[model samples]
Target: MMDIDVPGHIEKVAELEGHDDRAWCVAWNPTKPVLASCSADKTVRLYHFSKTDADTENPSVTFVHNTTISTGHTKTVRSIAWAPSGTTFATGSFDSNIGIWEQESSDEDDEMHGEGVKTGEWECMSLLEGHETECKCVAYSTSGTLLASCSRDKTVWVWEVHPDADFECMGVMMEHSQDVKCVAWHPTEEILASASYDDTIKLYIDDPSEDWFCFTTLTGHTSTVWSLAFSPNGRYLASSSDDCTIRIWERIEQHKWECVKVIEGQHERSIYSLSWGVGKRRGDDGKGEFGGWLASTGGDGKINIYEIYEPPSSSDPKGREPPTHTLIATLPSAHGVHDINHVSWCPRQGYEDLFATAGDDGIVRVWRINLNGQ
Candidate 1:
């Protein structure tokens, strides 16, 4: 066993409330301090942080509800994903439609007074309708040129975002044997990964002759693979599953990937969502903290944080060993027995320590992690 000696703790920053029904997904705007959460109430809510709300010195910040936009989807809005540009977002709904929404000028004259825009400030730009069943998740590529959606129809669809903002169906991958649960894009690459109820994760690559093809399928989970997240460097991927485990995959070659670590017996119930971020590591004299971090939320209503420790050369007498995952902190009932549906880390550079979690309790909670245990 490795002697992991960094103290870690999680502090609740804010509890955002508005949705009348279960909040299914939460996503942070890449270029802004705003956060968007979608719900079973058929509405999407945006949470905004003003200059006062971003007081890093305060240790906790409370964001205000910016707006709530009702999507046209009649069924539950299952997932929300923001584009890299932060100007647009996409929603996957149980109505089997994907809605692309963009920020529009609100008629309310409240903006000049520092008040947020109107509730209906967002407009659906386009609807991509093709799924035969509920669309479970949607994600945009790092460049925002490609969008991927997975469905209960057991199919994954890839779309090309045109210059006019119109989406054209690139190809459909009907490889999963069961309902697709979540889809995620590589942080720095065009590679797309989709998890499914069939206990598999498929990675897709663009092919000029074939449109998009399944480059690889990762297996080993004994139950439904609920979610996936890629490391900031895009070299590693983490997956959570109904089997109550988290699996880590690393890139071995340009087109090859393999599961290198499996974390089991951690959560009491299914692990629903996973998010990766940079964690601070204490120095040799316990002075500093900066390294790889991972957060997982689950059906057990618990949120756990782990430190990804990549040790030094094992052959050297003074060097450390191989990479290992050490649980740093665990918050029980983070959502008060309400299963967390999603957890997303803030994408901004200065706010990487912040994360958001949405749950069946119809609330989204923002958390700040103190890796230094100060």
Candidate 2:
């Protein structure tokens, strides 16, 4: 067993014990270590820990799921994501709908251990309807002004959130014929890329005035493109697939782009998870964190941490290896794990080095990436 960072450094922080179906999706609350998980059981559960007031070093926080929410969907939930603020969350379900959930509790309603009816204090706020078939995934733009939903009906829908008025249906993007499995937004641009079972990744871009538009379709993965992510710099895109490989795409001279590096020979089974780090980059003159690096999980029951090293020199030419990179770690069955579905980095930006992942084995594992190793 290779001692990699992704899984080996993880600890089973919590095990939600009541779901009757497979947990398909998990997301860390953008502002906290708290997390939410969606399941085929048709329910979404919220988990958090309340530290003891007296203990310091031996402080033990129990995994307490304070609430269970089930509404706005007629079938199993497939995907869930927390907004940057963490108070509101979005979920896409097999019922072809996206439901908005909010933290609905007052000081009186907020109990440390939770109150009656809803233990954890979460409620479905609104239901979004439009898709003709099951929705597979959903994401919010960096500004949280737009929400993107992808469905098996071969379309990606964008919705605009209006706090004072009824939510508006922005636009629909149809560029795939098969089920779209994943949708990812560029860190800085208005561009969005989606992976489909059709074996193609389509990049969609929207101007400040236009509702949405398709800029390009990246076709390379031989099998279904299971997952996709844009690098922290927004210049490169990393994707993993059932084809059993990880490929990186970077914008080249002018507007053209090319697959620069193919990180292979790492997985023995299908690659399922790809979580890019979410904190400051390695070297920034002590200015601030830029959120570089990445981690991945796959069907081989393993996880990998890929550090993005700085380029050696401008004269080194494009498409060449960076000055230095270290796999740092290879984790097999992280903490004796098996059947992990996905992995996610905490989205709090400039704050956390932690993340959470869930799988068929019914355990949510929390991992901390230690750069200092101090």
Candidate 3:
């Protein structure tokens, strides 16, 4: 059975329903509560709440940023990402293209010359071309140099986007046996990870000598791995699968990863999404590299969090219960229908405890966890 509980009631802060079709992807600005949701309607909508410094009681409860911008993408937008700098954003679409949008002051004078300040709004700056099929995922490198994208066409395209240059496809990895489902950039390094219907997760690293070839492929999932994440510390990885379980992977050795433990019995359907807490747990011993907490979504339409823990010590050899990783909170109807496709915490964890998920229901849900709740 899918373990689900919605203790926090929801409030309608705001809603934008102009999409012509289902909205499959929504992403929060890495640094702000500002959000962007893309839909099959061939359009992407932008929203920004004014008081970004303040966290809402229930993010879904009100229309904090009633402003909207509809542009970019010609088909269903499958994935959206906020650049690390938070001033620019990127999105991938079934239209087989990726576009970069940035917010800048309208005065064409100081703006283009780098004198004007950022306007905190988004506008289509340029479109990236390379993928041959629907681009399912797009991610920016940690150092903010490259943008990695994957598609149903069975390939991953790495683009070098920096210093305002025309997005150039640096390399392409076409080893997946089936449709590629997800792509993620290493939080701190120049590495990339991808999941595919081929029942495997693969890693790609830049090799100046080998033309940046795919030097590593991770295999272990019985079913398709829908989502993958590199821990904030870059020492661990987490994957959600159709197998209805979340697997924690540790770098047992260089170029090789091992499944350390399994987080099971939380969801009843395929695990559509998974994300490790982004930072160190407060009041923690600070010895280990990652595992502050974890969140996942699946066919059951719920978001569940757990404290990633070590095996019980000798005093409790009988086995202690899993650490509370605490379902500290849950996201309701997280897009509904067990058809949810993705769930991700903002890049910087512990900030408003904000996370977003998108799926078949045509809704991109944003949530905030209140640490000081009654």
Residue pairs with backbone overlap in model 2: 4-329, 4-330, 4-331, 66-119, 66-120, 67-120, 279-291, 280-289, 280-290, 281-290
lDDT: the better of candidates 1 and 3: 1
The lDDT ranking, best first, is 1, 2, 3
lDDT scores in order:
0.86, 0.72, 0.69
Return the lDDT, model 1, position 11: 86
In model 1, the clashing pairs are 279-291, 280-289, 280-290, 281-289, 281-290
Candidate 3 lDDT, tens digit per residue, 65-176?
A: 4345565566777778877877777888888988788775565534543322344556678988878889988888887788899998999888887676368778899989
Candidate 2 local lDDT, 1-374, one digit each (tens): 43344422433444566667767778877666467888888888777744454357434345677667775478988899877766688999999988888765666544554323233456677888898999999998877887889999999987887883246887898889899989988888767889999988888766679767877777788888888888877767888888888888876643455777677788877888787764445555532333365777777787777766545334445655532335655667763546667888767543345667767665566665655442
Who is ahead in TM-score, 2 or 3?
2
Query: In model 1, which runs have C-alpha deviations exceeding 4 angstroms?
Result: 1-6, 51-56, 106-120, 284-291, 311-322
* Residue 98 lDDT, candidate 3, scale 0-100: 86
Query: Per-prediction TM-score, please?
Result: 0.90, 0.83, 0.81
**Residue 251 CA displacement from its true place in model 3, Å:** 0.9
Top lDDT hit: 1
By TM-score, the candidates rank as 1, 2, 3
Candidate 2 wrong stretches, greater than 4 Å? 2-16, 50-63, 105-121, 208-211, 253-255, 279-291, 312-325, 335-337, 349-351, 370-373
In model 2, how large is the Cα lDDT of residue 208? Answer: 72
Give lDDT tens digits, candidate 1, residues 1-374. Answer: 23335477778888999999999999898876789999999999998874454546654555988888889899999999998988889999999999998866655644545333334467888999999999999999999999999999999999999865699999999999999999999988889999999999999999877679999999999999999988777768999999999999877678887887899877999999999887555556432233378999989998888877654433442232334787887788899979998988887776767889999999999988876636
